[model samples]
Target: SIEIGENEESAMCIGVAILDDLSYPIAAISLSAPEQRQSDELIESAGIALMAAGRKISEQMATG
Candidate 1:
């Protein structure tokens, strides 16, 4: 889930759940940014980047 900070204007976070071969939880990737510098576009971009990073990590964990 992506959520805003409690202050609403302090931060933004996007998290991807990492899973094992059985699809059980293993770890996670969280990208956070200061809300002041995070516009809607920026947040969306960050989310995309986070997803890409998460994919890379999963691939490494699976094959390496």
Candidate 2:
């Protein structure tokens, strides 16, 4: 999500669910950046990266 002025702070946040073996959400991973430092393209890229990282964490958790 993108926040123009949430809590009086300009920031961008993105997250992805980390799922268990049964495909239940066990946790989440997120990234936040100052709005001024992030462009639309950067946010999109970050979202993709977060999703990949979340999947990796979920996989590790399931296997262990």
Candidate 3:
């Protein structure tokens, strides 16, 4: 994620492990933001959103 934004002054990234159908960690989910465009509150919001997404993906995999 070093240059994912390419032209940003500063960026933040947060990720969570993604679990397989068997509940094993098989991948990951990452959320990124450009510091100049995001406030600390926004970054926190994105972190929560990222976690929620990971949980939803796990739930879907478990159901399917």
Candidate 4:
């Protein structure tokens, strides 16, 4: 799960869920910017990146 917060007038800080095997978010990634450029596109790209990151992490944990 990812949460976005309007922390500033020109940016939104997003908190990403970093989970463990238990399906709980044990960590997170936060980022902010001066408004989202082409929000739809940015969101899609971010989704892909997060999914890839999550999959890689899961694979590493299962193997190591």
Candidate 5:
């Protein structure tokens, strides 16, 4: 998901959910930046990276 100008500081954010082995939502990971430094392309890139990281974490949790 993406959020822009929706909070008190009006920051921009990208996020993804972390799922457990059963595919249940267990947590989330996000990145936030000031509006001036955030763009659609940046958000898209960050979202992809965050999703990858979330998957890694989920895998680790499932193993341990």
Candidate 6:
């Protein structure tokens, strides 16, 4: 299990990774903020995006 966030002053992204027993990431989320938008609000917004990403990946893997 891992969570990573990147803030480049102007832009930011939040990421989360769920690893398998073998330490391979089974699912992951990567969210990007709007241009020149780096703040607590942006982070909060990214969380929702990341959550959707993670769920989408998990569903794809489950079906495939």
Among the numbered candidates, top lDDT falls to 5
| Candidate 1 structure quality by residue, lDDT tens digits, 1-61 | 6889864567878888776666676999888778777788978887888888877877778
lDDT of 2 by residue, 1-64 (tens): 3445564477667868899999999898878778888887888888888888989999999999
Per-residue CA lDDT of model 5 for 43-62, tens digit only, reads 78888889899999999988
Regions more than 4 Å wrong, model 3? 1-9
Task: Give the lDDT ranking, best first.
Answer: 5, 2, 1, 3, 4, 6
Candidate 1 Cα misplacement greater than 4 A, ranges: 7-9
TM-score of 2: 0.82
Which scores greater on lDDT, model 1 or model 2? 2
lDDT tens digits, residues 1-64, model 6? Answer: 2123334544555677755545478666666556454666766766777667776666666566
Whichever of 1 and 6 has more lDDT, that candidate is 1
Candidates' lDDT values, in order? 0.79, 0.81, 0.73, 0.61, 0.84, 0.60
Superposed by TM-score, candidate 4 places the C-alpha of residue 49 at a distance from the truth, in angstroms, of: 1.1
TM-scores for every predicted model = 0.77, 0.82, 0.69, 0.60, 0.84, 0.51
Q: Which number leads on TM-score?
A: 5
Which 10 residues in a row give candidate 4 its minimum summed lDDT? Answer: 1-10
- For model 4, state the Cα shift of residue 17 in Å: 1.2
User: How would you encode candidate 3's per-residue C-alpha lDDT over 37-61 as one tens digit per residue?
Assistant: 7776877787788888988988888
Q: Please tell me which model should have the higher TM-score, number 2 or number 4.
A: 2
What stretches of model 2 exceed 4 Å from their correct place?
1-8
Q: For model 4, how does the per-residue alpha-carbon lDDT over 1-64 read when each residue is reduced to its tens digit?
A: 4334544655655455666776776665555555645385786677678667866775566457
